[model samples]
Target: MSWSDSFLVLVLALAVEAAFGYPGRLYTRIGHPVTWIGRLIKALDRSFNRETWSAGRRRAAGLLALLVLLAVTGLAARSMEFALAATGPIGFCAIAVLASSLLAQRSLHEHVAAVSTGLREHGIEGGRAAVSMIVGRNPQSLDEAGVSRAAIESLAENFSDGIVAPAFWLGIGGPTGAVLYKAANTADSMIGHRTPRHEAFGWAAARFDDLVNLPASRLTALLIVIAAALNRNASPRAALRALFRDARHHRSPNAGWPEAAMAGALGLRLAGPRIYGNVRVEDRWMGDGRADATAQDIDRALVLYRTACTLLFGLALTIPMLIWLIAS
Candidate 1:
C-alpha cells in the first residue's frame, strides 16, 4: 500500500476510537496479549545479566529478537489480509477492528481524563492514584500542583510515545510496523531504566525506542503547536521557541519535545526534581509559567491533546484523499 493509503487507515482507526472511545474494562481484558508479550520480554531480560553481558552482545540479541518478532507479526498480518480478501467486506472490517485495537488513542485519553476527574471530585488522593498508574514517580507526597504536573506531563509525553508514534509507524509500514514499534516501546518501558540492573541489558531497547520515536516526537510538538494556535490560547511561535529551548533539558531527547511544547502552550513549567526508585535527580524545568499548577491547567492540557489528535487525524485522512483525487 502507498503511504497515503496507510495514512488513511490510521485516520479511520483514530476516528473509530474517538467516536466510541475504548471498551475500558473490556479493552483492559483484551490487553492480555500485550501482557504476555511483556512477560516474555521480562523473561529474556532475566536471562541476560547487566554486569555479565557485554553491551554489544545484548544489542545483538535484542536486534535478533526484534527481527524474529517483526517477521512473525508480518506473516500474521499478511495471512489475515489474504483471508479477509477472500471473505469480502466482513473480513476487511475485521482487519480494521483488529488494527484499531493496537492503537491507543481512546485508552490514552480515558486515562488522562480520569486523572482530571479524580482531581476535581476526590482531591489529591484520587489524582495521585490516577497519576501513579500513568507515570513513574513518587505520588504519595505530591500536592495538588505536583499531581497536575505529573498528569499533564504524562498526557503530553505519552501522546508522542503511545499515540502519534504508533500511528506514524503504522502509516509507513502497516500492521507489522505498528506492532514492532509497540513491542520496542513496551520492552523499553519494562527494562529501560538507568539502574544497575537494566543499564546494560536494556541498552538496545532504549536506544531503538529513541530512534523510532525521534521523528514522531518532533511531529507531535508541531501538531500540538498547531492545535494550540487553533485554540488561540497558545501561540505557535512561542510553542516552537519553548520546544527548542527546553526540550534538551530532559534526560530523554525525544520526550522533551512534546513535554516542552505542552508546557509552553499551556504556560506551565514541568520536569523538576522527581524521585525514581528512591533516587532523586534534579531535572531541569521546562517553560516559564506557573510553578504551582492547578486542576484547571490539566483540563486545558486535555483540550490541547484532543485538538491535536483531531488535527492529526484530519491531516492523515486528507493526505490520502488528495492523493486519490490527483491520481483519478
Candidate 2:
C-alpha cells in the first residue's frame, strides 16, 4: 500500500480505538488478536523450547522459533490487509477496524480507572483485585499505596507497549508491521524472563521485543512530557529531568522512560522495589517524589495518559504529510 494509505489507516485506527474500543462481545466471541498470537507462540515454544535440549541448542531453536513466528505473523497480517484492501476505500475502513483492534488505549484507560473505582468503593482489597487483572504482581501482598503505584506504573508502561509502539509500526509499516509487533510483544510476555526455564529459549523473543519497543518507549516519554506541559498543574521539566536521572536505572531499557515521565508528571515515586508473586525485585525508583501514591493519583495519571495518547495520534497524522512534503 501507499504511504498515504498506511497513514490514513492508522489515523482511522486511532480514531476508532479512541472513540469505540474493541467490544467485549467481540472478544468473547473470537478472543483477541493477541490471544491468537499467544496461541501461536505457545505452540512454537512447546515445540522448540525443549527442556531436554542443551541450553545452547534451546537458544538456537528459540531463535528459529522467533523467525517462524515473524514469518507467520507477517503473512497473516498481510493476507488480512490484502483482503481488506480488496474492498477499496471501504476496505481501508475495514483495515482500520482490524488495526484498531490491536491497540489498547481506551481499554487501558478503563482498566486503570477500574483500579481507582475499586479503591474508592472497597478499599485496598478492591483495588488489589482490580489491579491484579492488569499486573503480574501478586495482589495478596499489596497495600493501598502499592496497589495504586502498580496501577499507575502499568498505565505508563503499557501506553508504550499497547498503543504507541503498535501505532508507530503501523504508521511506518502498515497493519502487517503492527501485528508483527504484537506477536513479538506477546512472545516476550509469555517467555521473556530470566527464569531458568525460559532464560535461554526466550532470549531472542525478549531481545527482539525490546529492540522494537526502543523508539516508541522514548517517544512515549516525550509525548507524556509534552502532554504534562500542556496541562496547567503538571510539571514537564520534572518529567524531562526524571527521564534523564531515573530512566537509566530501570532494568528494562524502555519501561523507565514512560514510568519516570509519569512519576515526575504526577509527583509520585514509582517502580522501586516491588514483589512479583513471591520474588522481591530490587529495582531503582523512577522519580524522586512522594511514595504515597493513591487512587486519586491514579486518576490523575489516567488524564495524562489520555492526553499523551491524543498527542501521539496527532503525531502519527503529521508524520506522513511531513514525509510527503519533503519528498514533493
The candidate scoring highest on TM-score is 2
Report the C-alpha lDDT of model 1 over 103-134, residue by residue, as the tens digit.
77777888888888899999889999988889
Q: What is the lDDT of candidate 1?
A: 0.80
lDDT of 2 by residue, 1-328 (tens): 8777788889999999989999989999999999999999889988888898999998999899999999999998999889889988888888999999989989999999999999999998899999999999989988999999999999999999999999989988899989999999999999988888899999999999989999999999999999999988689999998999999899999999999999999888999998888999999999889999899999899889989988988888897788789889
lDDT, each prediction: 0.80, 0.92
TM-score of 2: 0.98
Instruction: For model 1, give the RMSD to the true fold.
Output: 2.2
For candidate 2, which ten residues in a row score worst on lDDT? Answer: 1-10
Tell me the deviation in Å of residue 154 in model 1: 0.4
